[model samples]
Target: MSVVTNDEVRRELVEFLDQRQPDVVREWSLLRTFAEQRTVDAVGGCTELLNSLRRAARDGQEQNPAAAGFDDVRPMLRASAGGGASRRLDLLSLKEPLLRLWWEHRAGTPAVTDGALALSSAVDALRMVQLEEELTAGTETISMQRQQLTELSTPVIKLWDGVLAVPLIGTLDSTRSQSATESLLEQVVVQQAKVAILDITGVPTVDTMVAQHLLKTTMAARLMGVECVLSGIRPQIAQTMVQLGIDLGDLVTKASLADALSYALQKTGLAVVSADQG
Candidate 1:
């Protein structure tokens, strides 16, 4: 039989914990190191843990890993913030004091050993639930951070009146390319700018695939009534574009962002002449 499968063991363990609930919470709360005391929600979390154990001890839904009381742990874990290996060890550490008390209460008896085993299983179950929830929270946090990073990397700048620019600065993979395009188009529609600039000065290489991404973004902007300017084409990149026979087909290209900005200013019926010019 499984450790938690014994009815008599569960009954005895629950009763012992109920009578000495305060003691268990008090001792477990004391085991915290100074850092843990500050990092974790100490006394309250310990009380919640003890209560969860007692509930799990009698909970018929305990057969499933998703026990009713385990859900209570999620809030505590969220407040803990750094719920990594140390937290897990601390959870297991709780079992020791409770077991010691049980041993002292009924030393050298078969019932003592049995009840100890049951309590250990219940605590371990609670710990596993906490660990699982921590992992889930961690994954969600990472995904959100990644998305924020992507948005940061692909920013749409309102460079001039009726002109917006996207200075892509890394490998233009399909995902990033799509993100860049979406951001640029949204700004174009929002600002209703006349010219959209896709500057590739920081892009390391220009290949057929890269060219395709540029063309798709350009065409997308054009469909929205915005003329797209492809800038940052060095001599080497121009040569590569030619050798690869990647026809831009009347796509306006510029040698630098300065030139692109000048062209955009002109196309929008604007100018950047000398300050002294009449």
Candidate 2:
């Protein structure tokens, strides 16, 4: 195969693009309708890509020009990913008009053929870069969502002036357990509460591991000068804990939230008296 000089390739590409300017404009106009909500202006993007291709041919090195063009297009590609547009289809659609023009201007010439191959290689490089950008964007989105879920799963609610309660729901894995403990301890310091309640009414079962998690949380709260109360112990859970020989040591336990709250209020030197009693 014969190699074509950079100058020859640049000349052929320039001529092809100049002759097909109107057709390229029409293609972009049509594509703009599909990308209306996207930040990437289709017509401007097409022009930029063409200019990059021209520079690559002119310099005989595709990386610099191609990379710059891809950088310009990266944000647009990320926007498209969020908006349900197919990146591969967009690339193919953009390439069609230019490829058609190239084929028509210098179909049978060996030098122009090599030039066409180089142009195709540049387009493929742009695609690879776009894919990488999309992957990074996706990973970032997942990390944010995970953080939000953690916050939601371990909500610390203020029950009174000097009491905070954390209601645990669903499974109690090591990760969730740790998060709940940290959140409770932080709220203890922030609210200056003397009492912290861990309610497990929504918990379906109690096992050795679950008991251990509760013990650890109680120990942590004690270290912060706050007493911890465990509530929502159903009959089944109590039976399970007893059968499993899970000793909760000195931790206070209550059968219900109301009982726990009543105890907390008493510890804080506040009493709820009925009008009839008075």
Candidate 3:
């Protein structure tokens, strides 16, 4: 039910930091080393944070000094999160030294309660900012990983001249299907491929949706003047396709990639024959 003036809190905080400078430096040095080992960049490390704290305390009369402190370390926090460091551990390492210094220095002061309360608010603000940064960083990381996975899942390899192959593995979700279609289409243009092979041997199952995705991809390749061949038709998938009434309607399907490749080579006016056969 009591109010603490910014000026009063700032004075107390400055004194606290100044008095415990030695301890602060020593603790901060250890934290800096830890951050460097983890991040290799000291831009938003302990030293920068200490500078921010000092600036925030000096600018106590500002609207939100704690927020100012958080801004300084925001970039560092994001880097830590992006690097997949333990957020809780990083926070503990950063906050413990400052909190210990405050606790030791705030004892027996005239406005001890008010100073403690103000410091607590500042600490809480920093924690909240850290959480937000971590969340943003985590979301960005997940998005990047998802894109990498998509690329991995739908790998379009240049099997031979004028021929490209996309080996699809796993369940064909809408997103993955879209990605595959785009990647194959792009490769068709880039490679000037006359033939594109879609091998789904690693695919676990094929439903109507999977069938539609294949149709769409082949259609796209056709528009680009490239013949798309669907390979890796196991018995179970063929049966499912028939039962689901998924009409692949004259889009060339092959039993295996080797067979498809052979067909493609033949179309390109090439042939593979054994020396003994010759």
| TM-score for all models, in order of appearance | 0.86, 0.78, 0.78
Q: What ranking emerges by lDDT with the best candidate at the front?
A: 1, 3, 2
* Collision pairs in model 3: none
User: What is candidate 3's local distance difference test score?
Assistant: 0.77
Tell me the whole-model lDDT of each prediction, alpha carbons only: 0.81, 0.76, 0.77
lDDT tens readout by residue for model 2, 1-278: 87777677777776766677767656654663446524445666566655655555555555442355456666666765665544433564556666666777688886567766766776676667667767777888898898788778889999999989999998887877899998998888899999999999989998999888888988989999999899999999999999999999988999999999999999999877899998
Candidate with maximal lDDT: 1
RMSD of each: 3.4, 4.0, 4.2
lDDT (Cα, tens digit) per residue for candidate 1, span 217-272: 99988899999999999899999889999998889999999999999999998888
Q: In candidate 1, where is summed lDDT lowest over 10 consecutive residues?
A: 32-41
Report the backbone clash tally of model 3.
0
Model 2 residue 201 lDDT score: 95
TM-score of 2: 0.78
In candidate 3, stretches whose alpha carbon ends up further than 4 angstroms from where it belongs are 1-7, 11-23, 30-44, 54-68, 82-90, 93-109
In terms of TM-score, the best-performing candidate is 1
